[model samples]
Target chain A: MSELIRDFARLPQTWFETPIAAIALTLAAYFVGVRLFKLMRHPSWFPPVVIAALLIAAVIALLPIGVEDYNRGAAWLTLLLGPATVALAVPLYQQLPQIRALWRPILMTLPLSATLAACYALLIAWAMGAPPEVLASLAPKSVTSPIALSLTEELGGSTALLMGALMVTGITAIFGVEWLSRWLKIRDPRLIGLALGINGHALGTVRAFEISHQAGAFASLGMSLTGAFTAVVLPVVWHLFV
Target chain B: MSIMRGLLWLLAFLLLGQSMVQLLPIPLPAGVVGMLLLTLWFVRRGKMNADVVAVSHPLIAMLALLIMPGVVEIFFVAGRYADQAGAILTALLVGTLLSVASSLWLMRRYMPPLNETDHE
Candidate 1:
């Protein structure tokens, strides 16, 4: 009986070491987050992604699993992000007219804002004496993951650090935009979405969807424009200086 | 199902993007190139591509879920960089706040009100 019970206890350990467990844990955490967000009446502070992360952290604390186990198996999830990011074209396409009509302001807003966001973080981090690697990672923090990620690698920043910074940027933008817009008495979804998309990147776009579809559409536009702008500009500048 | 068809179409675009990145000296990633290619393709047609839409809708709908793992990794990473944590946190917060505020102001200044354009 002791032998049989011990074998049964070890089964979960073996399974948790596999990729299936990692992927399954992620999906389960996310769905649980979704339900909880709804239960809490869709508060920004309790957004699904952050809640999901917390849930996964809880799993780590409760079980024998380490983040490495999940990291090893969960790389496939990162691959899926590439194609999903490409699908953003759908929203960009859907918002064509608004994009076409507001071309001037968007053209104006993107270059300056994208440059401002990147420069401010880089300057602050540098001034505060962050190591060069940290500064490099911070360089692309404002751009969406897919684009910023490639830049991060090219710039020799840590992917893990960039991922953390990217999340912080998005979550911060989501909370900050809501609060700032309210304080300034700004009501335009277009304006709010631009702020979110430009500052938050994809995460901001995700949050904007919760506000309204109009906001969602504009946010996607903001994200794509910012991504493209940074993709072109950052590398040339980096190569020139380095 | 149409879902598979949509994914296949996206894959082709992704592949094209991958190849372009290889052949050219562009700074853009394959996936972003893929997105821009599809967007330009749709622009020429001047409409949404139904096939892409089939996959995109579900993907976009679950985007938060898709992004969760990356965010989850933050838990593990936050501690490793604890030394620079304050600088990193302050920069992200202040930078994001200033960026958003300035961007919003610029949009409001340059563009007219929401009703002024066919934004929806």
Candidate 2:
């Protein structure tokens, strides 16, 4: 078995062998997450991302597996991100007519939402005594993954750490969004999903899908707009604070 | 058309990623720059290819799950923040809450109802 494993690792095929394990783990995590999510009545409190993270963390700790091995398979999973992001256009296109009707409100609110969120981050960081790197990393949490990772590295934060934190934040929001809405008695799926995506980031977007199509569309739009708004404004805010 | 459109957006997102790493003048994260670029494109074009959107949506979804591999790194940071956990955690909790609350409020105020036309 050890010799077989060695030979398979040595195979000239990085693609097939490397990502297979990660894919399997991811699928396992997904299956578990789905069950838990369903059992929980699909509330936002049971965010799949967070559950998956915790589960994966536990598995790695107990199994004696290396990240390199995990990543060998995980890397293939990363390839799906670009295509999945592109898929967001489908719901957006369907919602186009409604989006157009509500254009004024969206245009007016999105920037303000972005600014307020960034400002809050700045304020909290200022109050918290967080180091510069943490501040920089926290600054871009609302954006998508690829962009968020790049910003983390650029801003002198640990890209890996920031990525992890962003994932946590997104997942927490995704899981919590519905519960928050129900607790608050907020019924608008569009508002709930958009708010989650904007504040929760990618994790929120995933949660958005679990709800309804209209809600998912709004979440995607919010995610995109917030990213743009924060990209333009976060640095400016950082310059002022840091 | 489908393949070309997907490729274009993919290349564009990739370029945006590059720009975040390079062209952006801010002290912000590069990934944020790419996101900003994508958002700008959507805003300007007012439409994106359905195929492209389909392709990109899942990647973002997967990102949430992808974070598990980095837990070892988080354990390392836990030490650094340990001394300041009381403060930092407070700040994180507060900041995150405030950001979410305000963002939702503003989004609700500014965003037109979803049932409205897409041209807005």
TM-score result, candidate 2: 0.75
Candidate 1 overall Cα lDDT vs. reference? 0.84
Candidate 2 chain A: 10-residue stretch with minimal lDDT: A9-18
Per-prediction interface RMSD?
2.0, 4.4
lDDT of 1 by residue, B75-116 (tens): 777778999998898888888888888887788789877777
DockQ of candidate 1 (2 decimals):
0.67
lDDT of each residue in A89-116, candidate 2, tens digit only? 5567667666667677778777776666
Error of 1 at A88 (Å): 1.6
Candidate 2: interface RMSD equals 4.4
Give the TM-scores of the predictions, in the order they appear: 0.92, 0.75
CAPRI grade of model 2: acceptable
The top-ranked prediction according to DockQ is 1
For model 1, residues A109-227, the per-residue Cα lDDT tens digits are: 78998999898888788889898789888899888887888889989888889988898899888988999899989998888988899899888999888788778889988887788
**lDDT by candidate, in order shown:** 0.84, 0.64
